[model samples]
Target chain A: MEVDKGKGEAEETRKVAEADRDTVTLKSSDGKLFEVSKEAAARLSTVLAGMIAGGSIDDNGTDLKQIGSEALENVVDYCNKHANSIPSAALISSSISFNTAPFKEPEEWERKFVDRLSHDALFDLVEAANFLGMERLLDVTCHKISEMMKGKSPDQIREVFNIKNDYTKEELEEIRQELAWAFYDD
Target chain B: MGRHSRRASPLDVDDLLAEILLCLPTLPTSLPCASLVCARWRRLVTDPIFLRRFRACHWEPVGVFHTIFQSGREHLSFSFISDPPPGSILHDRFSVPARCQDAGGGDDVYTWNVRGCRHGRVLLINMPCYDRKVHQFLVWNPLACE
Candidate 1:
């Protein structure tokens, strides 16, 4: 019984070591530990893939010099949490329903979760998503960014993105007048 | 330390940024405000590639309409010519309408005559302008009535 108990404890340690040690240690620009599973790490960007394949990522981890430390940390956390959930394909293909719904809500909690992000953070997340090859995540990020520019006047749009009026006043006026027919109706 | 291996200048950076920004779809947002702070940035935004990207974003949908005219009684008449798709939205999913359009406006094609139509089931009828009475023989195509 004593020998069996000792063997059981030893097996448990090995299992823990396997689970915990199997990681893609991403060293961010500021030297952070963005540990991720092999499956999750496979989603990383082209540059990272080269380093991963080359085994240049030392025993400690791979170094991601492009993305910042904080950003990399956030990305790893997102991946680890999301890895537990079902894949995107099964989720979207699954039929969803609600009761005889009259009044529609603007967004549910799930949508709100994604929506609650700053523009800069969203851009970083998109880069991360693209690197990770998270198609749905990338799509959501891009569409959110696109939504920012939709249906606003040219002046309003320029103002939102801090775009300089590079066009001369005369040129700007001409462009506005030419597309005047298009703007009013749509 | 004699010969310098020249690295890419600031212009290259601005050009790449401009290209990235241009790929996005039309939005109410404006860009290059930061890049346009200098003459080099100005050049990047004004590049032909940036302008071309904006040009490619949207296009006009082809419109087909038949302008109907009032005959004296409950009868009606109309005329239309199909213009090809404006170099866009031409996919296999689109099908030609059941009837074929016979071309007109030739050097001597008379406006009143259904000159060369072989299988046109409906003919466009034009009532004589300023006449209080509309033309009685609008339904020349027997298939249309059938």
Candidate 2:
């Protein structure tokens, strides 16, 4: 009986240790699961880093109820891509850095990654990025949206964003006249 | 617009929407257009906090406005020319004179004369020449008009 108890205790310790596994399983609101590199998620997302450090990460699937399946999949994809592309040395060195460094333009691959996303996907990713406190991802996604807005008129912008024109005709004319230079095309 | 109807909710969050709009390349052209989207959006774009953040993100001056003193017929006209960003392929230059409707026009009291420019504000020497030198100045922000 003493030998069996000792073996059971040893097995418990091994099971607990597996919680510190290199990869973390994230569960979406739709019951979908995505496996992301634990180190990369912790490094890129402050919320994830907090969860990891707080020992709240579940070896099974950590529930991310706020994120949908598609958004979670994109998040996982981004983490994997970031881990693969960013040099390990840079990641290690930039682990604790803030926004002190100058904003670097997104790489061609990053640009293409965002460009391929549909408008809804892009919006979802931005929300996810904000929720996760992923500043770089937020910047990249915002930059892509801004690019789409380039050279677009107010009418076009309203149409694209699904925003209604609240200003009356007179009010609109007043504003347009007030900022005539801005409204004029180059 | 037709395909992506339900996707608008995510962007309805004002803070997230502001973040995306703040990423615009230049404030002059795009932001004004964005402000006209809706009342809420206009308020967000015009908010002091949002403006400060936008300025922080884009600290570099998009273009420089220089003043050229021209001896016109009646008044000493100050022509402000906008200099494009460095390495710009297009060279489009336009100038507008300093106009102060309130300031009385005469030899002693005129609109303004460009003295200098520092930190995005144009220092203008107000008329009322005392000992061949202007006594007052109007520290004006041209960009504020935008």
Question: Tens digits of per-residue lDDT for model 2 on B10-94?
Answer: 5688888888888887645567777777788888888989887887787776665545444552333222233323332233233
- Name the lDDT of candidate 1: 0.45
Model 1 CA deviation exceeding 4 Å by range: A1-21, A88-113, A127-138, B1-146
Q: Write the per-residue lDDT of candidate 1 for residues B38-68, one digit (tens) a residue.
A: 3444465556776555444322222222323
| Candidate 1 structure quality by residue, lDDT tens digits, A92-158 | 4311121112212223432454587765565566666655554445445555554565444445544
lDDT of 2 at A132: 89
> After TM-score superposition, what is the CA distance of residue A161 in candidate 2 from its true location, in Å?
1.9
Best by DockQ: 2
lDDT of 2 by residue, A1-186 (tens): 999999999999887777658899999989999999988998888899999889888877999998999988999999899899987677766546833455668898889889889888888899889998888888889898878777777788777767778899999887777666544433
Interface RMSD of each: 16.5, 4.5
Evaluated with lDDT, which candidate comes out highest?
A: 2
* Model 1 CAPRI rating: incorrect
